[model samples]
Target: MRKVFLFIVLVAISMASYSQKRYENNYVSVVVPNGWVVQNKGDNGLGTELMSFYNDEYDANIYNFGMIIGFNQFQKPEFLLETQMNLKSSNPLFEKATFGKMYNSSFMGKSVKATDFKTQIFDETFKGTAYAFNEGGCTVLAVGSYKVGTKSDLPQIWRTVKWKNIRKDTHVYDSFREEIEAYCAATNKTLKQTPIVSNGERYVSVYLEPDANIITNTYKFVDMEKSSFDENKIEQIKQNLRPILLNILKATAKNAEIAAREMKEGYIFKYTYIDKNDEFLFSVKLTPDDYQ
Candidate 1:
């Protein structure tokens, strides 16, 4: 019996080590189990990132578990508490989630507030814990989902999220601004003169009508890449345009159906607006160059 117990303990330790994987950047480091894919770095937009680890092991169901980290010049002690209250009230999932009382906690020796929360989707209840901690002049968040009825090690994963002792180059925006001007001149579009500076990064807003047919809503993103000449950069612009597309679909065309297809370097967001009788009103191919 003593030998069997010792073997079981060794197996547990081995499995834990095998399941852990680490993701680190200049700002933060997090540990996630294998099978959690990291999103494209460019998709993070500026100093804030919403990275998720998605697992679709269950048929037709997906679980998103991850952290959001924001870098700022300075953060107050109340930052975490304010963020917790805001999330409890404003998060899109707040209405659907069943939350417990918020209580004080500490992570990596930094003061924090934590809450137990759960949400149901497709008849499966995803149990999770949310934490808000401010450390190293930044606001760090940890959110995770666990398989119900099991001993959860998610807090251990969160505890592994440590801040790095490095900072970003604040001049990236200035260099990107020059590129924006050049791209605008080449494409014959008016790039907004003023830029938004948040979290020590600059973002430029631009609007495109695509031949006087689509709506004139402006799209915005962090001015990271120098030019839209690259196919990959252009594709990233298309991803940024998705939210604008959905918001303007109704105003741009009646009963519109938006679809996207991948091209060599970029993508084509095809918008098909239909009439009351299901007849097509118009179709627009929203490409990356449109916003250049």
Candidate 2:
């Protein structure tokens, strides 16, 4: 019985909300609450707030927060409210904003926190549910959401918020983004949109345009020499070249058409673009180190 209780306790800690430890001088200061976590942010150590995270308990859903310090003043909790909306509709907040519930609320009732929301900035709508509280010359926030089983769980999950000492660490997304971006850069390609982390380390970039044909042939010409290409050497090279494009596209969709084929001089392996359509436009030809 004791072991069973101990195991459950460990699991609870492991699965509980995430936050860094904050301190003042030599004293122990409270970090962000345990029920809330940070996400999509660069490192700012544990003291300065700037981040976003997925709340496992938020009705088993996902959300993110971007904390901005000095944005709000004083010891009072001044919370900023915003949404990622295009403002296409006449009234976005009152009508279209589905990111959260009710009027934009604040942590401190008195102070005002400036807000900036960008909807479809990258040609895709990112539903970011975020909240920020500025206090003690510092800022803490929670934003974003994740896939959940049912919407009913939201209230119960949110109830877990400790709202005590919020701890957050910020690390620039540049390092990691640059790492993945390097893969795309090497292949002379740019992601259709900035990636939304589908889950840790992995990013999801979806391109949605009215014209389906535009996506179909985008990658056809780039990879057209598959048939004649040496299976091992050529394919291996192609994988090395455009790993990002391949990973994101493959994860989102299926069905690719081979636009071209060649093998004599060099191995050519062209396939349907990520959004494979009849207008195949990508191709890549690789040759063994020795000769074509």
Q: What would the per-residue lDDT of candidate 2 be over residues 64-136, giving only the tens digit for each residue?
A: 3222222221222221233123221312211233543434365333233334333331122434344555444
Among all candidates shown, the one with the greatest TM-score: 1
TM-score of each: 0.43, 0.25
For model 2, the run of ten residues with the poorest summed lDDT: 254-263
Query: Which ranges of candidate 1 are over 4 A from the true structure?
Result: 1-20, 38-45, 54-64, 71-95, 166-292
Model 2 regions more than 4 Å off: 1-46, 49-104, 107-128, 144-149, 165-292
| lDDT tens readout by residue for model 1, 72-158 | 323333444344444332232332577777878776666677777887644556777676765554555666665565455556656
lDDT of 1 at 147: 52
